[model samples]
Target chain A: MVSYVETTALRSPAMWFTANRLTTGLLLVILLILPFVAPRYWIYFAGLLGINIIATHGLNIMMGYTGLLSLGHAAFIGVGAYTAALAQIHLGLPFWIAIPLAGVMAAVIGVGFGLPSLRIRGLYLVIATLAAQFILNFVFVHWQSVTNGDVGLTVQPATIFGVSLNNETRIYYLILFAVVFMTWFVVNVIRSRVGRALIAVRERDLTAQVLGVEIVKYKLIAFALGSFYAGVAGGLLAYFNRFVNPEQFGLLLSVFFLSAVIVGGMGSTLGAILGAVFMTLLPELLREGALQVGDTFGFDIALILVPLRETVFGLLMVSFLILEPRGLAQLWKRAKQKFERR
Target chain B: MNFFIEYSIVGIASGGIYALIALGIIVIFKSSKTFNFAMGEMMMLSAYFFYAATVTYSLGLVAGFCVALAGSIAIALLIERVAIRPMLGRPFIAVVMVTFGIGSIIRGVVGMVWGPNDLQIPAILSRSPVMLGDIFIPGKTARAFAIAVVIVVGLIAYLRYSRAGVALRAAAADAITAYSMGIDVRRIIAFTWIIAAITGCISGVLMANVNTLTPHLGMVALNVLAVVILGGMNSIGGVLIAGFIIGWLEAVTGLMLGTEYREITPYILALMVLLVRPTGLFGTKEIERI
Candidate 1:
């Protein structure tokens, strides 16, 4: 399947530049106006969508770019979140300080988990990550001194220039800023020499090693980079929800992010954005659909919708892997090509 | 001393059930070269089938067992035909994700039909506790253990002597060679799945009898995963040993420390084992010829 990258490569640079400018300008205009135009609750979801976008971008770097599968990504996110929350509560640190520190904490833990990748690959590595997930989750629950156990921890909102960014619109811009910055950062990273090394490692480590690339360093860097994004996203999530809990960062959440990366287009920035938005909106869409069906059928089907949504999500993941492994990014590329042909 | 003996016995019993489930997983992995992430979900489906038969339909225990077995076999066969069969020759991730999808679908369907509430399956065994010189064992646990052991033994024997079993082994060793030899590798893979579903179903019911049936019963896959990884994914003997080791560790740890520690300990053990020996004990170290 053709990706946007390939399609853009095929077109003239001048036209490609104009198209890129137009799309970015349009997207920026839309994003700026969305909080004002959309319902308040929808803005909240948009904030969540942006947070997930950042997290999915991180996952894409490892799974999509580096060909490393982590079933324990949520654990890293949890570490970032708990670290951020605990820092705020115990250390009495400001949100700005706590958030970056959370990212560092998650990155350190991520590198520790990445050590197993050096010894194992494929399914074995997956299990090692799974181990990280469980062990970290256990700590989150059992280490009550900081985490507060099942009761969960509340996160104080951030402040910038003595202005409390507590409202949904404020958080929306904060997350949007992070999302744009991280997306730009990742795009640059992918184009750089390190990104090339990562892609090379992904294709075949033996071949990459023969070519004089440092496989271990790049792999760990991918982990650190990915988890760093997760950490920042987690901090944002805690802020958005105003609460942090272990349950939110379970294996299911990790699976969701992994699925988003796969379903979006693994190695593409566009894919991450598309996948995250689709996944974030999917449940809400399902809830609405279920509500409509219930209204039409005269039944209280709301209780079943959550599980049904989960099933549909799973089904979508399978179908995408089977029929369109390149994900929605590829699909968008194809549509654009068709339009050009027309 | 008696308390220790009792927990050990209970551990062994639960371990037997774990072995039973792990057997199904190993069986599928052996023939298909794919891990069945849906194994636990398949077991949950079986438990639901039993609940539907005995509780919903008021069928007796025997009927419930038959229905559960049949239901799981059907689900497994359908999965193989629809999902696994198409996934052949595709990327390994596709197969893995398909199983994950299958699992999600099973959970969703089960939740829709049964709702989220926990349902209890009446104890299949007589309620009397067994007293062996001051060490008491619950009858249900003992019976479940015994049944699981019997099934494991029967399966090992089947794999050893049966013609279909030999064909499965041949297919597992080299699918292309077995196919060229006219062994019908596809049929063998399908048969393996059927066997796995049956074993998984029985184990699920047995465990559900021990603990009431819930839609979340599939979460037991995590613990069983530790058992499989520790024992070696490819070895039935290793799985059995590992299962008992983990089960006893869990019981002992839960008794000695807080119950919460039991959940993460197996994963930690698995991580340690994978770090030290990626191939696992008794697992053949895969060599890449290229």
Candidate 2:
């Protein structure tokens, strides 16, 4: 058999940046100008989308790259939210410090729950995370003195320099910065030695161990890293919503993130962004559609709108799993390949 | 002391129902290595079907039970054929998420059809309180316990002695060997789902009778996950004992600590057990190799 191998090495940082630099520059410019041009609701929605993209990135790392499925992701996010809230209220910390601190706290708790991953995987690990979800939520609701007992905590506006980010447009910039930084961080991490180790552990831990991947260390690292992203997102959420409540971080939200990760394309950063955008926009699209139908038919959509959204959400997950397991990322790749060929 | 005895009685009775639900989960897990995350939703859907048959359509109790059982079995079979059969060699997480997706669909459908408000299912069991010497047990609880125990005992006996049951056990033990031995592993898998749906329907109705009929009735399965874990996922009989233990723990904690504690105690115990002994009390130890 005869074969040929093609290899292209980057000559310089400028050359590396120049390849696809137009698209990257365009995306950054659009994102920068979005808040100013778009309606208030859209800016608010974009902020939420950015937060979701960050959290979904965390999940993609653990589930997509590391092959550890966590059902308690929202709980870790809750941990970060609460930690950020408490730090701001009690310690008088700024948003930057509070957000990082939230990440650290959630990472610690995530490792605690992730301890079981050493002994179990797949279904058992999922149940363990489910337990973490309920247990943490229980703590949030019952720890009256700390979490305010379901009434939740009111978060103060995050101040940067002398300006308080009290509005969506202001907070959107903060979230936008975090999203870019986190996305860069995640992409770099996935290309590094640690990322390869995590992926190896995910593929088959026994093999990874034999290959000297240090399965235990990487597994915990995956959890810590994933939870840290969740925590950071949660902190942003607290500042964005100007409130932190138990109900906001529930099993449903965790499932939502999981579905996002799946629908986006596992193990791909672009997929995470796409999935987050799809999921966030889906409900809005449904509501708008429902209103159009209602307006035309003269029937109340209030009754069916929630159920319809859930049904579609579920149907999307099922169809994606069945038809395109690689998710939207694979679709995009195929499209690009076809276009380039043309 | 009196309160303790009373709580124990009620707790154990409720535990019997939990065992019934856990049996459904165990049966499915034993045959196919897939954990049915939608088991709770299956139960809740059947309960809703029963409510629709009995209350909305006025079919009465016996006919309603029959309709619910058939509906649940059909749904279970449909799930196996459509969702599960295609996922034969897929990753475990994908299958698990598919089940979650199915569960969400069922919940949403139930909410749409029945509305989210709590609806009363016509009482199948007597509601009056029963006195056992000085300790008092609620009538519905006592009767539901009796029904659940009877069903569980019958199932245990069937699995132990019957020919079909033996085939199921054989398949569960080793699929290839069982296939070579002239057993239809696929049929057995479907059979186990039928058994699960039947058990889920019975327990779902019992739970709805003891509590209230709502879309969230499936949440009881969260507690049952604790039982399944503590008892071991594949252990048929261990769930019975673990169910009672968790039930009693919930009752006692609810009495002492508060109602909020009742929800979390099982999860804490399950987590502790996972950390300490992941195989659980009666579960078969999984041996992994390259």
Q: In candidate 2, what are the lDDT values of residues A169-207, reduced to their tens digit?
A: 999999999998998898778777898787777666788
Off by over 4 Å in 1: A1-19, B287-290
lDDT, candidate 2, equals 0.87
Of the candidates shown, which would achieve the greatest DockQ relative to the real structure? 1
Q: Determine which window of 10 residues in candidate 2 chain A has minimal summed lDDT.
A: A1-10
Candidate 1: tens digits of C-alpha lDDT, residues B137-218:
8998888888988998899789878999889889888999999999998888899899988888998898898888988898
DockQ of each: 0.49, 0.44
The regions of model 2 sitting more than 4 angstroms off are A1-19, B287-290
lDDT of candidate 2 over B1-290, digit per residue (tens): 89988987788889999899999989988898888889999999999999999998999799999999999999999999998888877777888888889888898898888888999999989978888888889999999999999999899889889998999889988999999989999999999999999999999999899899999999899899989998988889898898899999999898888787899988988888887887779888872422
Note each model's CA RMSD in angstroms. 2.7, 3.6
| DockQ score for model 1 | 0.49
